[model samples]
Every structure is written in structure tokens, then in C-alpha cells.
Target: MTTTDTTATGLAHGWYALSLLHGRIEAHIERALQSGHDLSVREYSLLDVLSHQHNDEGGHLRMNQVADAVVLSQSATTRLVTRLEDRGLLSRYLCATDRRGIYTDVTDAGLALLAEARPTHDAALREALDRANEDPRLTPLVAAVEKLDGGPKAS
Candidate 1:
């Protein structure tokens, strides 16, 4: 005697599919990063936020602001920042206007690190793109993701 609901099974399959997709992509990124960069995914995301912050400003961001941008807990962000700071990739300075706030700025060392890592990152992205191209089913999924990710609309 078996007890299985068709609708519930279908829903479970859908969830499993999404989870598998997420896991595969994350693992691919991890493997690619391991080959060329010293950063974990979270750390790389923080660096990305800092790079954009520098681009938008003279080159500094509040520590809290970075924590918010990266969606990390305050204490976790602080620890991550401390690690980067110790590596000379970034600096933390007392905010002159608000003594309670700390400002973070990427050092020249960080910029050089970004420069050195960009090519490997780009290559990894290209490899992913190539893999996607080889899979016909993924084309529609990619299109959907692009739309959700804010890509330009097709005519």
C-alpha cells in the first residue's frame, strides 16, 4: 500500500529543481574562485560592493553601509573587514563627522588584487556562458533570469 499525492510530489520536484540549480551555480563559482583568487564568495561580494562604492565616490564607504550592501550581519561584516584590513587590501578609519561610525576604503593593494583577479573571473564567467549555450533547455531559463536581473527588454 503506497501513499503519494501527485500534486505534492510535483511541488517537491519543483523545489528540488530550484535547489539543484542554485547549488550547481554556487559550486561552479567556488571552484572557479579557488583557482585564481584568495576570496570566498562573501568576501568577493564585499569587495565588489567596495569597488562600486569607490567608483561612485572619492573612494570610501561607511562600515555599516558596507554591511547593509552585502546583506551580512554587522558582526560578521566587521570580522570580514578586519581580515581585509589586516591583509592591507583595505583600511578602516574613524569617521571624522561621527565618532561612532567607521569608514572603509580600498587600498592600492586591493585595486591591484582586483585587477589581477578580473581576468580569471571573466574567464570563469565565459566558461559558464559556454556551458549555458550548450544546453538548449537552459536558454529559456537564462532569459527568465536576465529579465529578473534587469537586463534590457527584447524587441
Candidate 2:
């Protein structure tokens, strides 16, 4: 094979491995959160993100920012917010200064659920990574994920 072809194949393999790792981790977390807290991965992520907002200026995120953070489209984020709102897990309000802008926040119940589910989420992630590490093909990617925190050792 030509050098260019070899490089492309290598990139493809790397991309596939990364995607597989992400999918496995997310699925594991999803199952744990759902069984323990009745929350899907996206819902948990949204609640966690909104829980970090503060009362300071620009502390609250707009719909677009939330969408970007959650890696979903704006419309999808809105729908998710609505679903959570219906569950009393989130609430939405107009931006005080910008009538055209709106913000979403995690309700007290949402915060409580997130707190309860966090351990489950973390445990599931660690378990998934540990299992993945057993496969030599996935071990390097797992190590990279472990190094994401910039720590000397994988936690």
C-alpha cells in the first residue's frame, strides 16, 4: 500500500477505537444512571451542567451554550429541557436582561438526583474503562482517557 493509503488506514483505525471507547463508556454510564436515578446520560449531563451555574453575571448559560456543552442541537436541547421540566427536574426562565434569551436551571430535586447518581456514574465509567483495558487494542485509548485529567496516574 502507498504511504498515503497506510496513513489513512491508521487514522481510520484510531477514529474507530476512539468512537468505540466513547460509546462503551457512555452506555455503561447510561445504564447505571438510569437504573439508580431514572436518568439518561444526556439528562444527567444537562442537570450536571446546569447545576454548575451561579448567580453571577454570565453564570447562566443560554440555550445555545447548553446545547453546545451537551453536544446536542438547539432544538433537541430544548426538547430535553422540556422533558426534564415536565419531570420537575429543571426549570426555565427568560433572561432578565435579554427578553429574547432564555435560561434553564437544575431544580432542587434535580440537584439531589444528580448528587445521588454521581457515584453510580463514576463507578460505571471506571468499570467500563477497566474492562476496556483488558483488550490490548483499547488499552492505549483507555490510558489516554485516564491522562485527560493531567494527573501523573490514572485515578
Instruction: Give the best candidate by TM-score.
Output: 2
lDDT of 2 by residue, 1-155 (tens): 99999999999999999898999899989988888889999999999999999999989999999999999999999999999999999999998999998899899999998899989998999999999999888999999888786537656
Index of the highest-lDDT prediction:
2
TM-score to true structure, per model: 0.71, 0.95
Q: Give lDDT per model, in order.
A: 0.71, 0.93
Residue pairs with backbone overlap in model 2 = none
Deviation (Å) of 51 in candidate 2: 0.9
lDDT of 1 by residue, 73-146 (tens): 88999999899889898887776667986788778888778777767665765566556645664555545554
RMSD of each: 4.4, 2.2
* Number of backbone-clashing residue pairs for each candidate, in the order shown: 0, 0
After superposition, the stretches of candidate 2 with alpha carbons farther than 4 Å from their true spots are: 150-155
Q: What lDDT does candidate 1 reach at residue 50?
A: 83
Checking candidate 1 for backbone clashes, the offending pairs are none
